[model samples]
Target: MPDETVTAAEPGVGTPNVERDIEDEEEKEAEQARDVEKGGVPVATGAEEVSGGKEERDPNMISWDGPDDPLNPQNWSFGQKWAAMGIVSVFTFMSPLSSSMVAPALPQISRDLGITGDPTLSSMTLSIFVLGFAVGPLVLGPLSEIYGRVRVLQLANLFFLIFNIAGGFAQSKGQMMAFRFLSGFGGGGPIALGGGVLGDMFLPEQRGLAQALYSLGPLSGPAIGPMISGFIVQSIDWRWIFWITSIVDGVIQVLGLILLRETYAPKLLGDKVRRLKRETGNDKLYSVYDKHDRSMRAILSRGMVRPFIFLGTEPLCQIIGTYMALMYGVLYLLLTTFAELWVTEYGESSGIAGLNYLAIGAGYTAGSQIGAWLIDATYRRMKVKNNDIGLPEFRIPIILVSAPISVLGLILYGWTAQYKVFWFVPDLGVFIYGMGTLSAWLAIQTYLVDTYTLYAASAIAATALYRSLLGFAFPLFANQMYAAMGQGWANTMLAFITLIIGVPAPLVFLKYGHKLRERSSMARKSRIIR
Candidate 1:
């Protein structure tokens, strides 16, 4: 997490300070020129010879710093790594917190802004924020690849912070809608970038806990935010929703400036090359990704465009994206409706209504933590069974188990909430629902990461677009939906639909997913054959 850019060299070479060794500088330059003539980057031969004795060396492997360089993200101290993970999780938490914090304040916002008293309109306020989350990942996810994760992520957060504050002053519904959408666009960067950053920082085995911790941000933030927002709305005014969250986001941004550093290997190496060239006049030193033929404009365009391309063509992305989108939409729907259900049915106060979110939060925490360890263990076991070859299908078994849990949760929450059943009944149902959702989500996300690897950002972005849009759209219609069919039958309808789509999805994917992946041009290109 320190602000140092790691420059890769041969396996064991210490990067010489270009400031010293003037006598050898000219000789080194001539040697590098000869290497270039032979179409190779000038590497220190002595460094290679020194490192070769200890381990297997791949001369063609692209590296950042030496194999064991402390500057590499892989070599960072555990404390530094955890701190970085915490920073990203905090960043990830703010957007969703903003998205749902206003749930308890909907009536206040509706009254003061002169909006119609329709629950659908009120839900739109929160859902539209989710809509921005959907749109943002499509572009931001890809842009992170071209510019590196930290820069795009921080810039997007600033954009979110700006619109969030602006939402505080909106006098009309139109302004509120516009500000919410824009703020969401900025806020969504963390959702798209969080996993990719972990991929950059940690190896596969150590990544689970970090990812599980990060997963809590999006899931728990919404649950927790309204706890405070409910109190604020009852005591203060709805305007403070924007003002208070913006202040919190500002603090997060300041901490990020201090702690978040670049992790992308290409960017780090590119910076090193530029610095080295300035110091030693070695203009030819460059990364494999660096090519004179490709302009930054082209790179940016390609990075931005690839996710959509993959989304359109890759069946793996499509199936995973669809399921994940449904899960996210349901989450927002629950957040939007929890206050109404509790306050209306159980005659709870606003603060008490908000507290029900803890059920969902508990479910999420348990699912993610348990799911993390289970996923890794499953993946490792599958790897062992497959002659030490890891298949994407290695992740499918847990997803299969989670799918039915999701259906059951829907049934429990819907039927219990329909009757004036015990308050704890609905809470337990929601907790079950939350666990199932998170479990499915963790499996889908880790599968996507494992399957796509380098293009994980784009794949996630493609999913983000639909998922966020659905998150927005679901709440907008929840009131209409429940009114049309009533809560029990309505959610039963949803459960049936979920079964139709989700149930067979995992089974099909688990059995034939490898072959399906083989047909994907992107997967083929990445050489991610199962």
Candidate 2:
């Protein structure tokens, strides 16, 4: 691969200019090494800085010390890379766990808090957390770009821990809602930034498995939470749900401090520039990020707003975001309604109904593990056929298979429960739905990361905003939708909608995705794939 560097030359000027004489490869490598020892690569031979009416060129422009620098997160050891992935995965798990942990306890909480007349308010307590999820990434994702990933992530986790612990002490519906929202706000950090961590640590070729492993946290947490909380809410006070999760989060925070390291290359190089300026008394030491004269506020404002811009302008983000949102919405809808389906239809206790969630968890795990292997293998096979060049479109084919499975699962789940048939039949449908949802999730996430390598966090944050909103709003109307339409038809409605939205997405990307990406401003700025 060609060196991924930021030269002062205009875009597309430095590489593959056949009309210009190519420099000697060995001599160029040797010169780059000497430049690294001097603190940074020069801006370019004739590059001039024009800040504040100054016309002099600054020779000290910082970047990675050649492609193999150990400081670069991409070059980190396998043990270190996996360690970072694991820590972020743990952080990712806690938020989704907390989101649905309160589901089984909602009735008890409603009764204890005297939430009478309207069950909507009670459901609000559970769904309001996802509302926070929708809003947090706009600020947190950009903050990661500016401050660094480890710092932002650890601080956000601490924020989540504090608010979540406070939730245990709530005496009123208002207090509980406030605490849950704040906790969720903090929880959004890992979801927004975790993709960027994977993008930083692994090449596109190796990201499939890492993404699949990381995905298990968010996908399985919602399924697993209700299972554990069901028993806890039965035997223990409902308040212990918050208390126990907070304690687990505290432990994860400590692990984060020990294991997580700064992965954003710009932030790392910026720090290096600051240190060199202090040690050598040279104010001209700068980085490519410093080429512009924007203030911190301006930079943050732009960063915070970029996700919305991508959503509006980029077809890839729009299509994937819509599909992921539908999948997420359905997942939460199932989480909210599955237990009720069992209790009301099958005459099972809350605890027994909650056990059905384990089927969903099992499907998620199996699907993620299998999808990981399939994605990596398929990409490798395609790369070999294409002369070792990989495209983001290689990630889309699996979703074509998974989407239909999800639609089938939804249909089966709805009809089986509506008829009040054998209990295990509905469970089997739930398991299938879980597997299908997770497989599609793995493909979408991996595609986004590969397509928007440098801006992976922002792209994911944009997609996540749509997803969180759908998750928050879908359950609010779920009971009414199911009551009016009946379980069989209601879920069939969802299945059809899923088919309409989900089926075309992968096929479109498979055929025209590269063309769409070539025209995207975000994709052009990323300049990582080509």
Q: Which ten residues in a row have the lowest lDDT in candidate 1?
A: 1-10
Where does model 2 exceed 4 Å of error? Answer: 1-58
User: Would you give me the overall lDDT of model 1?
Assistant: 0.76
TM-score of each: 0.86, 0.89
Clashing pairs in 1: 8-65
RMSD of every candidate to native, in Å, equals: 9.7, 7.4
Clashing pairs in model 2, backbone N/Cα/C closer than 3 A: none
Please provide, for model 2 over 1-530, each residue's C-alpha lDDT reduced to its tens digit, 9 standing for 90 to 100.
33333222234665433211111221232233333333434434333357798554345767777667898787899999999999999899999999999988888888988876776788888889998888888888878767889999999989989999999999998999999999999999999889988988898889889999899988899999998888898888899999999988898898889988898776888898899899999998776555443355654665677687679878999999999999999898888888788778898888898899999999999889888888989988998898989988898899999999989999999999899889888889988988988988999999998787656787898999999999999988887888999989999999999999889889899899989977765565465423
Reference-based lDDT, residue 507, model 2: 86
State the C-alpha lDDT per candidate.
Answer: 0.76, 0.82
Residue 448 in model 1: lDDT: 77
Which candidate achieves the best lDDT against the true structure?
2
CA shift of 196, model 2, Å: 0.8
